[model samples]
Target: MSMANLSFLNVLKLDNNQFTGQIPLDLRRLDRIKEFSVTNNRLTGQVPALKKGSVSVDSYAGNLGLCGYPLPLCEGSTKKARTGVIIGAALGSAAIVALVVGGGMMFVMRKVVRKKKEDPDENKWARSIKGTKKIKEG
Candidate 1:
């Protein structure tokens, strides 16, 4: 990423990777970053003060060697992290439900497709739809 041409990055989705060291200082310069994340990695050091609602605690986990505000000043980082986990879990559960419902809907549509393929009457009607004769009134 050339520092010369990254002025409009609204979302920095760097989750679930192996990036080490502290959060890059240069990132603070990007005011357009609304969804910054560096979760499930080995990143250490203080958590940066992200623009409110722009970043969440979920974006700073799986690393057993990091602390600071948002992660919970120092004394309560562990407790706060637990809460974040519960929240993440709830969100995760909702996502799973959505996927299941979507999958079921797709499955039902596939069955409908198969039934249509099995029914010759439906096929013939659909095939002749554009060729049907228009009746004239006397």
Candidate 2:
């Protein structure tokens, strides 16, 4: 039988069990619940909000996939987290691209500068010779 049908239940403890799947949201309908515990279970999915102080972190312990208030916010907690990750990855990629292009340009410029320094007058002499016409040796 479902626990939600037990509307008159005041205290429910199902700790240290092999229960799997989500804790039913209908459990919140048990208005008479004064104490609830589902710790040490294989429960997954967000834990439903029950009585104000009836549930705590300890009540949902050992369930790694469970989340929501009274525990950490559920994974992906809407699109904000996913969007942030996407934006972060995009910015990281852009930075990498910028670094690669900048490094390539710097390397090319350095090579040109070194070549000029090594043969400062090589091109100058060639240009001067081209400008002068050869005289006949008769």
Candidate 3:
């Protein structure tokens, strides 16, 4: 019952089905496939490189896992995507840390400035007693 056994099939449309797993390589043997499609299926892995121009790019639509020609390149074929994600996460974390530290520094600085302003005579009493000497009582 393999699809290869149907060598005479000229048009095969298996779209919008619940089919899973890779598209059988045997289907490539169908030299007479003039119109083919497996869109909106759960098919995974690369689509067989059947006769060029025999299948449209839309034929693989909705198959997120399917790749190769007529579809997006597979995950292995692109490293920038993962690298970009990692870099983006790192930058986001760094930004958050900087904001927290900056906020803390600003709070502390404001408190110190406010204390100085509120106590303009702060240490004036200590300065007045700086030259005072302790006297022994008879």
Candidate 4:
């Protein structure tokens, strides 16, 4: 059911074919496969790991259902794993937003405090009435 038995075959190029189904799990046995390509096919499932430099992600492009390693992990593959990733991302985003908002609030509060310190009467509730009373009496 796989191409593993083809011992003498050193290179296999099956790009742009309408091939479907998972990659041969026994593909790792092809020790002499110096170059391989299976791009632009309708294949699915995790690609079998071959020797380094024997195949690259370019060899497996155009297959949407493929996942792992060279491509991102598939959604819903592991509920716990996916949930952990989501939680981590949410916490990271919340931390950034909190930092920005807290920093802004601190900046605004510091400005208000500094302004109040610069002119104490500017914020007093009775300063205007006191000024009016002084003017009337004068």
Best by TM-score: 2
Predict model 3's lDDT versus the native: 0.84
Candidate 4 global CA lDDT score: 0.80
Give the Cα RMSD of candidate 3: 11.8
lDDT of model 2, residue 123: 79
Per-residue accuracy of model 4 over 19-107 as CA lDDT, tens digit each: 99988868878877888888899998877777645576787888887875566765666887879999999999999999999999999
TM-score of each: 0.46, 0.54, 0.51, 0.50
Tens digits of per-residue lDDT, candidate 3, 5-119, equal 8877888899899799999877778777788899898999878877634687888888888997878777775687788899999999999999999999999999999988866
Error of 4 at 58 (Å): 0.9
The CA-based lDDT of model 2 is what? 0.85
Error of 2 at 89 (Å): 26
In candidate 3, where is summed lDDT lowest over 10 consecutive residues? 45-54
* Shift in Å, residue 118, candidate 2: 89
By descending TM-score, how would the candidates be arranged? 2, 3, 4, 1
Q: Could you give candidate 2's per-residue lDDT for residues 9-118 as a string of tens digits?
A: 98989999889999999888888888888888899987788864457788888888898988988766777888999999999999999999999999999999998897
Global lDDT of each model?
A: 0.75, 0.85, 0.84, 0.80
**lDDT accuracy of residue 83 in candidate 2:** 91
Name the top lDDT candidate.
Answer: 2
Separately for all candidates shown, the number of backbone clashes (residues 3 or more apart, or on different chains) is 0, 0, 0, 0
Candidate 1 lDDT (Cα, 0 to 1): 0.75
Mind giving the per-residue lDDT tens digits that candidate 1 earns over 36-74?
778788988777675434576777778766777667666
